[model samples]
Target: MTTGSQRTRTVLHLPCLGPDAVPLERAVAAVLGYARGRRWLRFRSPGRPEGRWVRVPAFGWARFDAHPPSTGPDADVLIAEGLHGRLDRTGWHAVHDALVGLAPVVEAVGARAAGRPFWELPADEFSVLDEPGTVGALLRHLGQEAGPHPAHVLAALHHRHPDLVPHLTPTTRRALLPHVEEGDSGVEAVVHRELRANAGAFAELEAAVAAVVGDARPGRLRLHDVLLWLTTTLRLAHAVELGEHVAG
Candidate 1:
């Protein structure tokens, strides 16, 4: 069994993803290129090409903003919103309620940090992870309410405080940090360490994305989330092909 001190140390000392892990120019090119492809529309009926492909007037990060009931401007609104595309009404409610219920705890923790970005926080602040009824309890509660997969919980937290919490998808998490166990109490700590470790890369990515998107640039955390999600799931080759097609 892992002791409290051991877990704390694990969180504090978690390894970072080096700068080379994500190539700068290549990643930017891939994302911009992929955006040119039409968005996928699923068809509930049996055949019919399975779904229709629709042109997205605004692609890439802009698409995130274009959709109504925009996910942001308020953390609570973001948390209450569920992944309607992926989850049924029941699943959505469970995620929504579970995340909304944890608002107090999340707010309390955010209060302590005084709105500082997680990347800027010192190791000592992360001690909250080891506190008896804080982060550990939050994780347990999330597990109970949201069921086993942690992506929704982490995603909700990310929306609430993009700077403090990194958004996670199972594919991105596994591709980026395969060794880190999901559902572990120390998971957030590990994510914190990883983000801090690769802060420079993410910052560079943010700049690149900003340059491409102009005024509509998304937050660094969101860009990081999108980058990981796309690169890991779509594969760089497909992204390049899409980019080439767009350029042509």
Candidate 2:
């Protein structure tokens, strides 16, 4: 189904970052708590979707082609766990491809990906397990292309306004401190400079979001913290999605 006529369900991708990934089992449980019984589904590259966790009525499931689903292209939402760095090509392809897809995919952007130099769009969503309202809002935005992660949006705001960074840090920045202080020249300058350069990408992203989801920017993101913190998960989500897009 195309975005206009497709069903809307919030999906989360969980990629295996590594042995040190802070236990996704715990993360999922936390997400469930945040969701408060909203229909949460999981899937993998079964084309037929044969293998999946079946426990609740709302518990839809998938079998990812990658260790986690964030790397996949067909995911409506991804919830991988890596944060140490950007996902591999497999996952990146999946996310880029999924962005091309008619549906919206939500992946967990890792902290490393967030803090690391980015000449590209931000995908950071590593873990907002602590914030239900924020996560809930993000679920709403999953259908949109969201070219820039929520973090990017905040970064733009931060670049223009520093005062908001403090209140925004909790849900936006997560645990990573700015490579330099918020207003420092290099980190601060690079982020905003890239943001300006990314006008086209952001436009494309917004177009994607608007095409699929209309003009409602529901979710919130920080340009550099939460995403990188759980960097491994993001990589994992994209890997899963890439296979789906390619096979399809």
> What are the per-model C-alpha RMSD values against the true structure?
9.8, 19.1
Per-residue accuracy of model 1 over 1-248 as CA lDDT, tens digit each: 33334322331112333334444555556666645555555444556656666555323343342223335324333442443135567666566666667667677656756778766766544445455554434443444445443566666666556665566666765664554454445445555555677676656656655565454455656655565566566556666566556655
Tens digit per residue, CA lDDT, model 2, 120-196: 32322212343332322343233234343433222222222221121122232232223324332223223333334
Q: Global lDDT for candidate 1?
A: 0.53
lDDT of each: 0.53, 0.29
Q: How accurate is candidate 2 locally (lDDT)?
A: 0.29
Clashes of each: 0, 61
Question: In model 1, which runs have C-alpha deviations exceeding 4 angstroms?
Answer: 1-20, 34-36, 39-53, 56-86, 126-145, 148-150, 175-177, 181-185, 240-248
What TM-score against the true fold does each predicted structure earn?
0.64, 0.25
Return the lDDT, model 2, position 239.
Answer: 26
Per-residue lDDT, model 2, residue 47, is 73
